[model samples]
Target: MNWNQALFPQAGPLRVVQGEARREEPSFFPPTHLELQLQGAPDAYGIETTVSIYPLAALLQKYPEQTEGSVGQQVKALRSLLENPAPLNTAAAFRLPAIDTVNASLAVAGARKSLSSANLRGVRYLGAFSQDVRRFASTDVRYVFQGISRDGRYLVTVNGSFSGNVLPTRESLEGSGYDVAPQPQDNDKDRARYEGEVNTYFAGVNSTLDQSNSNPEVTRLDQFVELLQLR
Candidate 1:
């Protein structure tokens, strides 16, 4: 019962089949989408007011006649809309000049619609690749690539640091055309500068986080405890 010979029959000291080559993809992932809606502005005298995306949409739908408001106010309003979600109908209600510019940028950047099922006429969603980058850059996010052997498995982890206070480290491998190894100083002085930027981003976003003791670290610890209990 020579099982090895039976499985891979080749006489005269055959070669062992090892790693499989990866299939080449037709295209890479699409870019992330960023649709911003700016609204609000000051009056002739200098009074300013603003509204959320939903409310702004309502205002736009309700009051299409008033377009000669403050430019600054409109910009602020549009920026707010991009962060917050509003109903499609609400978003359609108001028309702003910023949409054309933003959409133009999106087109140039190769951004795509979020959904394949329904129509996304006025909403904005980032591409899968962009979303992935954002998720990793959010806050202390880490990436782990896992592989297995017959006897054991191993994990390769890339721990992301904070940039700008609360934001996660962000990097892009696109547009360079090829991969290049970093120089030694590129790993230290440059790395330090990047980490510093992350610290700043996080600091700004920390205020926006839920005002609870339930930070990411706390959540991760809870998960670890639960896994331990299961074991």
Candidate 2:
């Protein structure tokens, strides 16, 4: 099932990350990797949504020798999904291909996110992630999820962000003009001033990290995940 079309009246960006090379590790093959970007609520920063779906049979048909024999069997291949929460923390990723290509979005915030054990209706061993970007006028943080379906038929991922926040990449600090970009002719004093500004900005983000306030978007997206039915 193509969730992009089903979830949105008009979906966006479902590419195979062009120039993808077959990595040395078959487990890191490229078939299970994908990309997308969806515009979401206007208020949330970097809150656009993007979901990637990869069909397992498509993987097998393309690389039968590389996939696990049992999973390749297609009839009883669901064993890959880790259901038990105890060992879920140590579980490896869904064996989807590695994303090694470059993307063209200029980012400002650190590529830091908090991850914990999580599961959606259609998938198990899913990891929930959130980034701290000094959210303003909105409780929404950039939430993301990635894991394989319970039946091992597909790999599913969800990144809640919108077209409004897609460009400039780092909505937290870069595009906000709080920490001004250093000019090519910046002197030592100018560099120090910019560094101080960035430090202050991150301190605010750290304060958010210390708070325990709940994000409503996480629950909303979780329900969306639970309702997804992947064949």
Q: Each candidate's TM vs. the true structure?
A: 0.16, 0.40
Candidate number with greatest TM-score: 2
The lDDT of model 2 is 0.41
Each prediction's whole-model lDDT (CA): 0.24, 0.41
Candidate 2 Cα RMSD after full superposition onto the native fold (Å): 10.2
Cα lDDT, model 1, residue 202: 35
lDDT of 1 at 73: 39
**Candidate 2 worst ten-residue window by lDDT:** 97-106
Model 1 scores what on Cα lDDT? 0.24
List the lowest-lDDT window of 10 residues for candidate 1: 107-116
Q: Alpha carbon lDDT of residue 41, candidate 2?
A: 51
lDDT per residue as tens, model 1, 133-216: 122233222111111111211111111111112322333323332112232254678877656654453333333332222444
- Candidate 2 residues lying further than 4 Å off, grouped into runs, are 2-29, 32-37, 40-48, 56-81, 86-141, 162-214
